[model samples]
Target: MAARAMHVLTSRVGEHNAVILSQEALSNLVGCSERRLRDAVKLLAAENWIEIRRIGGRGTVNAYVINDRVAWAGARDGRRYSLFSATVIAVDDEQPDANELGQQAPLRQLPTMYPGEGQLPSGEGLDPPSQPSLGGLETDLPARRISPPAGSPFDDEK
Candidate 1:
């Protein structure tokens, strides 16, 4: 149950270590019968491990303040000799409606093609000239090749 409490434990300014889970919900979370859960709660109280603020009558949730001396998830100052200020309620209701779930934009339809489909003619895509024309530019001179400097390691490779 402490492990479960850690998930919902609050660390607000004055609500440190408070868990506002319902008894039924806590029982379900701990995987135990409600009777067993009550017994465990009693035991924990006897050992000063926790303090129950409310028994949670109809339309209300059971409130528990875990002893920070034993387990705490908030800053030390918040739980150090502090009192409960807020709660963390867990709802056990039906699944939310699609509208309550919020709106989602529709996905865009992408173009599709089958295998070997939409083939281009063999010479159509090769319209660009293989070698760009250098109109009126001098191209008769041979490319100058600079040889490696003498006595350099690169000269030895040749």
Candidate 2:
């Protein structure tokens, strides 16, 4: 069960920087009830395998921080294990050039998804140029996919 929960958490790490799994979500993923999930989480917390933080006003939405070192140790000893790193890199928001946007252009803003809003177009939601669909393209032409072989560079002599 612990291994199953860990797998789900790690899979979502890319979408969420910090692995924050709600008890209900964990329960659903592990095929257990909320009570069982809570108990398992408590045990993991006691073993320092995860750090749980309760958010005020957010019902059952707890933040879980995975401890990779402890999880690895447990795995080595044939116990339930989880693997994750808590290290976080600070991102700098400074723009490359202030003058890149001319005075005529309005200040740039981040895109937001409102409740009733439909799915935004791809490319960061920025307006894209209207182009004809490629559905009518000729499919008879041969398509060549190029890639380097295992452990070999593109220019390898061999």
Give candidate 1's TM-score: 0.39
lDDT of 1 by residue, 1-158 (tens): 54443343334214456666677776776777777777777777677766765633472356667655323355675544334444665453522553544456677544444343343224333333233245785236557877789878778655
Model 2 alpha-carbon drift over 4 Å, by segment: 15-17, 68-158
- Give me the runs in candidate 1 sitting further than 4 Å from their true place: 1-15, 68-83, 94-158
TM-score of 2: 0.40
Q: List the residue pairs that clash in candidate 1.
A: none
lDDT of each: 0.56, 0.58
Best by lDDT: 2
Per-model TM-score versus the true fold: 0.39, 0.40
Candidate 2 lDDT tens digits, 1-158: 66666666666656443555456666887798888787877887787776775534665766666644233344555655454444322112223554553555676766555543344445665553334324665235567967668668674645
Model 2: lDDT to the true structure = 0.58
Error of model 2, residue 6, in angstroms: 2.3
